[model samples]
Target: MSIFGKFHVPSSAFALHETLTAVPEMAIEIERVVVTDEVLTPYFWISGVSPSAFETAARDDQTIQQIKKLDEFADSALYRAEWTAQVQSVLYAYTEIEAVILEATGTDQRWELRIRFDDRDQLGAFQDYCERHRIAFSLQQLTQLSQPKTGGQYGLTPKQQEALVAAWEAGYFETPKEAALTDVADELGITQQSLSKRLQRANQALIGNTLVVSAEYAAPDAPDPDLKH
Candidate 1:
């Protein structure tokens, strides 16, 4: 299964606006306006923006009244009032960022989250928010590769075997492939340096066993000649 979600944010909130703008092509539009708890004061109903132009206007800080070329329903006076309410609500800090939870498939779960901020100050706040909530976050893009020989292989642990097999398939011998040791490490949930060391030890054992078996087989030809004589 895969899941996707869109998070709504108000343009008046500079912090959120900056964050949303950094994401390509995504836009926020006012959906409804409301007043929340007394302590929180103002609140807004917002959803993703459509028609692209509306998004452009909102990001450019154009007044809702100035946005003349809106969709039929969107251009109406009632809609303009709603949009104004949304902007005002955000200015007063009535809305806060709720979590955007997207249920993803095993493969999609591996997707690396790439995020950017307007500047260092916003970056610091975002980092703090993620850390406080213990969110597993990364800016790098993520991909997943399947391994065929992963089930019940050697006496090695799942992580150890995954590293070993990935190394083998990638050709540790004559020439290296485009495969990343770090990818294997990340998939197996281990450190790259540690996985490398484990692969090395595994290689040594495999080589030593093959050499020993070949030597024992070579002794058979000489012994068989005595029996023929």
Candidate 2:
């Protein structure tokens, strides 16, 4: 069985920790990652700061080899970063254990990550790798799936799944007003508040599981011994 895990690590335990600390208000969402020969190249989206400010802060981060801005928006920018191969951060640990990063977002204080591993042994190996490297993390959630394809539902509870489906069918997610919240609640035989909460949780689960798992970069056959802590 595959395991889905969610956890948090202080900024000090991952790549770009210094950059995140420097820009306390900045938030980062990892868009994609490619790991090869212990080197990690990740594309990320940054908001709440300007590109120049982020570049300046990144200049002092020891984990980064290079960073290039790919696009810019009014409040957010996209960037591609190459991490130093020898840096033993949690990202490296993910590569070591062959874990797929489902979602990773960072703030100055900490990073919240959701990852899927092949099995319990792979998950255990990830934890062991973190311990060996002295990388501290807080485990938030753990779920086991009998098969991988079953993750389409993202571990939503029966009631949550039902509420979400009903709401969608009622057009509660439409851009223009197709259905009102109260109407969806009535259809589900639940209060508006309960329906809202269920929808919120369901949406979060969908995002966390579906985002950033595509376009995996091929890794080498064996881990790099030199990169081991």
Candidate 3:
């Protein structure tokens, strides 16, 4: 069974470190990190930055091989960039990453990442990779998944979990509508659209982890799939 583990990689190991170093006040939350066209494109939602300052910081930062703004919205913007070959090697070395979230803000430079692996061998290989490259990293948390896709809380992001709980308690899923999205959004100090998106994403993750397993076990037909992509 795969074990769930949370690890911390110091700021020096991330390509964004240089940008963060340049703009100490800026903070980023990773929405996704994907490998495309032989490059790692990390989509981040940046906060505590004005568009002008963000642009200036990214432009001035040279540690990252390349960077480009992908999209922008009110109070948040998305960015994509490529890391060095040594950084790329660590990501490719691991077959699966359960989750990766940016932790710390306001001059505290560090990234708390949660990842999953098949066994100790895989985790050890990654540690060796980090050591060989001299990347400062440490394991923070570890837990055993009950089954594939059955990790505690189904691996929901903290925001997702909190939003899910609020949604349930507020009766957002009720037929009579005991509460509305706007109410939850107001309480959470987020926009309605943001609340909706968070709830939807949370639902998807929960369904993927819990219901998918239930259906797979209950299905009578050969390889019956309950999930829709």
Candidate whose TM-score is highest: 2
- The regions of model 3 sitting more than 4 angstroms off are 63-66, 86-108, 150-162, 179-197, 200-229
lDDT of 2 by residue, 1-229 (tens): 7788989998787768888889887888663577767667777777777889999999988888679987675666778888785457546555656787766777888888878788898888888888887889999999887554442445444455677778788887889969999999888766676576557656666665566343332111111111111
Task: Give a tens-digit lDDT track for model 1, residues 88-153.
Answer: 323332333321111111010121112223344444455566456554444433222244443222
- Candidates 1 and 3, the one with greater lDDT: 3
Worst 10 residues of 1 by lDDT: 218-227
For model 2, the run of ten residues with the poorest summed lDDT: 219-228
The TM-scores, one per candidate, come to 0.23, 0.67, 0.65
Clashing pairs in 3: none
Give each model's whole-structure lDDT. Answer: 0.34, 0.70, 0.59
